[model samples]
Target: MRQMPPENPFDDDKLKEECGVFGVVGVADAANFIALGLHALQHRGQEAGGIVTYDPEAGFNSARRFGYVRDNFTSQKVMETLPGEVGIGHVRYSTAGSKGATAIRDVQPFFGEFSMGGAAIAHNGNITNAEALKRELIDRGSIFQSSSDSECIIHLMARSLQRNIPERMKDALRRVEGAFSVVAMTRTKLIGVRDPRGVRPLVLGKVGEKGYALSSETCALDIIGAEFVREIEPGEMVVISNGVVESFHPFERTASRFCIFEHVYFSRPDSILGGRSVYETRRQIGVELAREAPVDADLVCPVPDSGTPAAIGFSHESGIPYGMGIIRNQYMGRTFIEPSEQIRNMGVRLKLNVNRALIRGKRIILVDDSVVRGTTSQKIKDMLLDAGAAEVHFRIASPPTMWPCFYGVDTPDRDKLLAANMTVDEMCAHLDVDSLQFITLDGLYRAAGVPEGRDANAPKYCDACFSGEYPVVPSDMIAKGFEMKTAAE
Candidate 1:
């Protein structure tokens, strides 16, 4: 029997991207390419991985595992099982699914055999209205095999009267609400779709003369030697068959409200978005943060790994020396064992250790991408103080995350977020820091290449966590007495 990995007691106070999806058509050993792409996207999700392939002889084949892509999809013995020239894959960190005995069943590349032909789908992002849809479908006699929000699409497609898989998929999407970027495969075609708001990302790429690929980020394409063609636009769907590609727009047009956090945290530094380098954008964010909130400190330090690039920019802009005061353990997977009371009190020593020699008797400015729950920040502060640092100040790269995200990111509810209920002064007190400041919302817009600033009437991106302005209405939450906060509020 498969069991879930132990939860880490030393979890960081950061939001997590839910999943990554990839697909390829007209390629030999398509599952191999899908594996490579999923490996590149491993940073997005690491709990579980799956691949589904279609062949004329075998019809459809699927393999799902409860671990990293590199561990599960690398072996020649495993790759040989999925023989096809068309396939789709997914890497998941569960946002919606039962976390019990049936959890592995929820790992996706969900399949459905319609009257026309069978289609397999791998999806990123959450479906807010899934519970309502699931009840309605069950009332109509649809038996769900897994307890996952994504399975609603398969059942919805099974009930569609549309002529083809793409049309059925369109019909299904029209009924669902919230963010989605999907990669799917029918017996004859590979399909990709992004939601109307473009809340999650999907990119198109070309491989040699006869192959095409769809991936959550350009980094996946880079790993497989594929050339990025373009990002799949909001509300756009592409179908690839027999080396030919066709595009369709099924949903009504809306201004693309891409997730701003993609720039602040989610995406890989090597990937490009909207033609801007992600690393450069992050560096600019740090530059903006330094300009907006400078501190009198002897050294600037980063939380390590994710915080490195921004810290470099802060050091450059603030004219402060940058040093590695905190060193992270390289082998620490996000997974952590359940801690006893004594271990829980021990805090960050498991994943990070302070370089006491560099930290002693120095005032330090710490740069991190964002703060979510405040636990990690508090622990880091205590660690720094224990290391004999004279003072510790925090400069965040983004504005206070005052609202919960209902899109692809796995954010805590509003009540759990420290910024949602506290002022900067209150947060500083809570963390027991000398000072705390976040980058202004306008400064973030400037760093994101919109120098004119966020227009109150027509905002360019989804800053829901910062601005409480969600592009897509969260229907399920509304039904549960959750009120949507408009930009004016």
Candidate 2:
């Protein structure tokens, strides 16, 4: 099958979040709850979705489809086949496996059978050492079923000598490196585990009385009417069976370094991370951006959905009026077809249009989350100019994205990241904007709840994309000749 094109091909210049994982145990029609939870997390990944449920008589039943959760999982035809009280689901955009034209085999909630029992897993972060593990495993006679790095976990578990599935899972993860938030299921248990650095997110929640859930964000729990309990700590593993919960530390303890971009982007605005509201944090970022890079303009406009909260905060801090100068077409979807060059050339206009009445003769301050390839920024700026805007000033909510992320985000290579190649002045000139400014790394940390600012000696969050200081070494990329920043540099 030819890989389906992105929803808005011309406007897809932002970094893509890898995946979202969700599981529920002790609920009636658990697949239904899983569907709702995955729907809430659809922002994380939109290429494909899968669900696996275990019933005593039916055994393990799974449905993997290449599309949005609503389009595939909402049908009674698919849900009826997956009847069980325990289920786990995943929504994916393919950061680690095949790129375009995803094969049905690559759709996740990957399952494996072992001597102890059968287990299914849904993983939310990238595994940096996947290639090395795959090479070693293949040499040892492990026949792989898919190209996904997440498949390594199941293979490793199969090789473990542990007598039970949970212990074997611990054994499997112990040998792995890099960021991960995994939700897996065995015959009677729902398991959730995070990487040693907690570079990705995973939260635990409770349903009515005896039910429990594990999800990539609090927003998903809300969809299923599950009460937020707490986050699965860095390196901590939890197994829920029959309404009882068991926690274990599967890896050596280390200082936590959660991904900072979760606050800037990636996560849903309504979700909570580390006890702080994601939307509030984004607004705070705008507040900090205004203080760091003030621009005098008639109106403060956002790039659209992702940039709205930050733009509001910017307006509040800068004492400028916020206006909807650009409106997004909410009905456009991934399945939108561009059958000809004429349609393709319409580009960003299909997704966003400038409000000529609001923008005419106005000096606008455009607040956006980040600048990736600079393509979308250029297009949006041109749209504003064509609408008779006198001046366009760009204020970015996050620091320059100068590096690619290996911890589950799908970022362009270093050469393709505009910030990596061009200075702020050069970027401003290239985009033909009157001015362009990004929030300082320290400002971002402050908005993310670090009041004292980032301590270079012990930074609080994983800001590899901005600081080039990765919490976990990306072994596979390094082996492929990717360079790391030195201390002196």
Candidate 3:
């Protein structure tokens, strides 16, 4: 069902950053490699970024700052200040900590100091049982600092047995649920792990003698000139030391149901998830959408960057001419701050301006990957109509989002989702569009290269945001640990 989006209403339907992490070891420039990898995976987050490097002589050196990777991290002094042969980095979008309310503590590469030496860790997902675990730890007298779920893992590691690093990590990992693709750097080793269901993407790569780089997307490897190895198998722990990589499966294996949203929205188009090029797959989503909903559109105009490839495919299959309608003013959008309702609205307007000449008096089919808040979609569609579009037909490449994410996405409460309360016809009328359609779940599965029952384990996807089958249930779905603590303080 589709409900019309309000011009300024809240929506939890938008795709969100799942978080990005990367680590490298035994290289002369591990710090640089990590920074580059983080840049490639920048789409994963923009709220905060950091890198933690390990050196025998100086111990661990960490540099992090809140904001976009280019804006805060890798600044001239930051890059000069960071150095080591082994390190880990993260690009984060805070779901809890209030805007500009976070300190260095909130940023990741949360370091753990214990009897077995220390380790610097970077995480790429949310913890489902965070509140319960934090409460339990608080009862045991664990001092909480930041409201980040990633910090929970650090405290868990600090309390684990001191025998071996891998054993300690595994001990803590087995207790956490939801989605996670973690990378950690001990004084001597780099380690990576994925949840049993593989709800998030993590890949292992080799770059010369340094040999290993672990990242949320394979495109990070391309940024650093590393050769792509296979994915870090779900439910497995990978330890890379002395230019050698080994795997250990301590947790029971589960079905390989990778998060389908990665292909539809989260990942970099150039990146490869589950061994498929994200750019190519998104285009296929468009081709499939065209076959499913053959609309009478004079021209196809993509929503911009992420929507472009699929728009091309829709144009390819539907015989409609593909034209660039929205040109993102990246320079402006990147710097625009959204601390209030008015600013967020003004920011969106300034971010993209419709081409009156192309859209005016034309039957336009606007192809977008997904409609999260529908705020942006409604505004954009209206912008086209204001530019004199004869008629606007909306084509979404994915199913409507009905559930909030427990993994990592900062989905608003369920009630805030546009798809939650409205049907497609209702939504079309609400948005005042000429017509609307969404790709079927079956079509979404096919776009991922999962052909029917052929692969056996094929088509298993996390459509929690669409079907509401949450992979893991967080104890308190509404707990704003990050903000709740602030008010208490």
Candidate 4:
């Protein structure tokens, strides 16, 4: 489980959604299995969740529940409530949602009337060109109920060709900029698409006979007893129908630079990624961290669940004992839900407590994936110091998150990032640590390499969040965001 931020001041080290999408076809109870897959993928998004299932006898049935999957869509009774053999699921993080119209309308599985009947689509990535596309659609008299970028694709599909939904989706997809791993349902076809850069995860799986599952991670496949197959390629679309699956990458293929963050902090340990095990990848990062920056510390401690892999690797490499310094109380549902001001403070305190027996009088090297705002790390350092650690040295397995991620990650605005504004020395001083080391960008790429920088002909990454080099620029670059009130908005 990941630690959340406080109500005000954005004081918590919250990592946003990396976007999770799932699809299933051909299983006996595929609709229910899709729900199970969604439960496994709930970690990807906590804001809005939904499932669109189809029934051969009746029709497409959808059950949408907002909030955590456990609280919103738990119970076999609920699973049985949905009907269908083929289905698609989405857990989302909102970007443009507003109180009046955007939030409600944007809850996905956007359905539209089209030439080839109708289709329901759910998406997990942001489109840099959404504003432009929305403007174009509105100008052409297309009405929109949702403000989500996901809905843009639905409208585009609606205004597209009659031959096939998949082809129409591919045609529309070719025009959109940024990351997307889309799953759509139609009367006769189920479609899946991944953007050219492969910034998000979308993998293929099979349950038994005539059944397949597509998801952002393998954990869902495990839940539904679906065997892991392969990843949907960058610039590719796959369609399922009549016990057959076909793929088309009409757009030119590009290099795959699977988002490095997936292995660093987003994905579950049990999931396999990009030819390597997630746990293995995180552990290897620790091994590399030790080789690059090693220290003679008494104990190697992980931040919590996210840092466990690197801690083990650090311990193995340093020949130092590994100990669970911070014990995370998995039972804490939401840190923000702590009732009162005092309880909120206590809730943060109660979430994790330093293991006194292991840290007392020991020089500790604290290993974590990355630090967003320095507040949480500083507090943890103070906590460890209070627990009697002789000294604290912080080691980050992934490169410092120097930039915000706009594609799907819930990164704060530029000024909020610690690494972007402060020097390494300044950051260490701010966190009040004896020393600190971050994995280099080159090292990150070397560990989880991406395609060569934008070749003139190939599709590229929207590193705007990382490098401030967004693929598509806003028409109103000077305008305020959704958070701004009427005057600014």
Candidate 5:
């Protein structure tokens, strides 16, 4: 049996985004550019990273390592081994297969050889129908490599009767369900695709004179000095070679439902999504939150990093002075080692500290992105009170995460979710905070530039984590006895 790695003691109580993908074609030493792109996307997946490049002489070369991209992919020796003009990479925190015990084989940019040619693919979404497909493939005598649902695509492609690699990819994806934004490469071409729902994100960028890149976010494109071209449309595929691009629509069309949480937390504030600035959207979320749930406090402080933008908006909208009442230790990485039980007990203090002088005698309004299990929130409240703060009010930027996301994010099961189990008042009491509130679902949609707010029959974006209205049914989970919301409930 595989043993799970010990959970990070200082892990924040928030949903984790699963992975990010980047690929470069028509560039010299493409692996180097891919490394920089992946570094910009490190926040999407910090546990492991992999890069694959193909050289005429070297054929296909790959390097997958467990750790941050800066720690593993920056070595000159490693880059030299992957010499090629076309390459693709992935940074991953597993939402499928293996979980905490991620093996190197489970790392992506998974390569497969076809009768027509060879290809490498890095996927950034969950496949809902994976188990059923895996079983069918196994029964047909396909040898499995890694435990990832993503590998099922490789097997499916291998079994395709299409005349070329690109066609085979379409054939494979046509049979897949749920969200996906894939970056893939063949010997001479780089390909990008988004599922019909557009539940995840993928963008095209132009690099130098002839090079083109595809990335999970435009922020990754910025690292390589690539000009943002446009997003890969939902149900669309683009193949690029020698500076030329070809477009294909392989799947049936549907209304796009890009993940809305990317604006709240998953994406970097600098990124552009759906032609709107992610930073501006998050700041607006705070503005709306202030309007919907106003609280009087001596100081408005953010939980640091993720909450900073929203806190700024909240402060501006509410006329409250903003202060750094809670300070985060910037040098602390998620992989920080805790050797003993005594050290482990230090918990959140290892990564955050209360500003004793500033917090003394102040009534604080703490702004955070979301509360998953409530462990971190309770600890932060205790820290504030210990530092002589008179009162602490909690304001969350997003609506309460009441449902688990089956579309690439690593969310806790519903039973473990704090909001799924408690009402707002109960949660406030549980955390021992003076007050607690979350941004309303309609407010969130408004902040994302939907002026009319969410429609009951047709949502503009994927807000399943908050509203429990999943666009794609999670067949695998349902088979495991997981219950979904009923209409009458």
Candidate 6:
């Protein structure tokens, strides 16, 4: 067994990536490679991890565990049980299913046995029409296994009249609405697909002359040294069989509205997308924030780790010297208990500490990627003030996240979001900061490489969290009387 690190204690005040999927074909130890790929994507989802491998001699083998990928997928004993030349893996943070022990049954790669052969699917993103489709499928006499919306695809594919698994998958997706990036495997083929609107991310990569891989991000490809071929275009499906790749476009073409949050926080900074580095994009976002909301401060201090890169950019742009005013305690585990109100109030201090020497008597600008619940920010401010910091300003890289994400990102409901319920000045008072300002929506688009700015009539990307313009109707939410822009309005 591999050594287990402490669970992440830092409950970030930001959106969480729901899942990551990976698949490989034409490799001797495909499960092994997939394990590494999933390890690289642990940031996407840390609650659970699983792998499904297909061996010519033993058929399909699966292993799922409710913890970090390193703890479950690494051991030689575990790898020995899953010998195969084709495999798929998934890391999940639970969007569609329950978070109890029963959740293991909902883990991917979800398997289906067709008349022709068996296929396993690893999916990322939520299906907006899942509940409606589930009801319809149940009425039509389909027995569901897990509550996950992803399982709806299996049921849909089972009912498809298409000639093969890939065609059947295409048929299944056509009937569903919402964001999805799927990696699937069969006895002889590996398949990858992205939603029509490209609300989620998927990439195609080559592993030397013999193998090909499909992954949620290029960072996964980099882990095993796979050369990224290209992003799987929105609405496109690619099938890899017998070491050859075939592309199919079954859905009507639409402007790609890839999730902007992926660049902001979901994806690893080292990963590249649309020929641009995610790290550089975030740094540019910081630069844009500095230009739009410069402040009079003695030091620019990052919240830590995720905010570090952007803070560097802010320092350069604002000509404010950056300092490590806050230091994170790496060994802290997520399982800390706050038994009382007083202990709960000290929760932020468990993960972070104020650097008294660096921040005392200095007006510090705290750079963070986004603010979700003002809880952590409020605590951080109190800590800095207690450390004798003269003033605490906040510079957020992204615009106020006023809307909830309906795709894959795990956003709190609108009422729970700090921005959704409060105005800028109200938020500053809530966070107890000297001043608080977020990068403008237009500035964020420019940093993401859209220089002309967002087109209100036809927005290019999913800024639903900021602009309340959803690319796809959230069917489940709509059924519950949830108006799209009502909160923002």
Per-residue lDDT tens digits for candidate 4, residues 1-489, read 011233323225766774578888776666677768888887787667787777767677777766777776667777776677777888765554543334556666677767666678878777766777888999999888865667788777777764877778877888787778888878766788888877788888877887888899988899988889898887788898777889888676667545667888788888988777888878877877887789888999998879999899989988999999989877766534636666656534667789998899999999988888777788789899999999999999876676666566777765788987898899998888989998765455444544242333332333344444444343333233522112331
Q: Which segments of candidate 1 are over 4 A away from where they belong?
A: 1-6, 334-342, 486-489
Clashing pairs in 1: 7-336, 8-336
Q: Give the backbone clash total of model 2.
A: 2
Which 10-residue span in candidate 6 carries the lowest summed lDDT?
Answer: 1-10
- Give the per-residue Cα lDDT of candidate 4 at 456: 31
User: Model 6, range 111-213, lDDT digits (tens) per residue?
Assistant: 9999879999988998999989999999999999887889999999999988889989989999999999999999989999999999888999999787999
- In angstroms, the error of model 4 at 395 is 0.4
Candidate 1 lDDT score at position 37: 99
Between candidates 3 and 6, which one is better according to TM-score? 6
Tell me the lDDT of candidate 1: 0.89
TM-scores of the candidates in the order shown: 0.96, 0.98, 0.92, 0.90, 0.98, 0.96
User: lDDT order of candidates, best first?
Assistant: 2, 5, 1, 6, 3, 4
Off by over 4 Å in 2: 1-8, 99-102
Encode model 1's per-residue lDDT on 1-489: one tens digit a residue.
011232466764778788999999999999999999999999888879999998888879999998889889999999988999999999987767766566789998999888998899999998988889999999999999988789999999999998999999999999988899999999879999999989899999999899999999999999999999999999999999988999999998989899999998989999998889889888898898899998899999998777878888899998999999999987876545557889878867888999999999999999888999999988888999999999999999889999888787777777888998999999999999999999999999999999998897898899989988777877877787777885466
Would you list the C-alpha lDDT of every candidate in the order shown? 0.89, 0.92, 0.80, 0.74, 0.92, 0.88
**Position 358, candidate 2: lDDT:** 97
Of 1 and 3, the candidate ahead on TM-score is 1
Q: Model 3 over residues 241-266: C-alpha lDDT tens digits?
A: 99888889988877766788899989
Q: What does candidate 5's lDDT look like per residue over 218-245, in tens digits?
A: 9999989999999999999999999998
Alpha-carbon deviation at 340 in model 1, angstroms: 4.5
Runs in model 5 with CA error above 4 Å? 1-6, 99-102
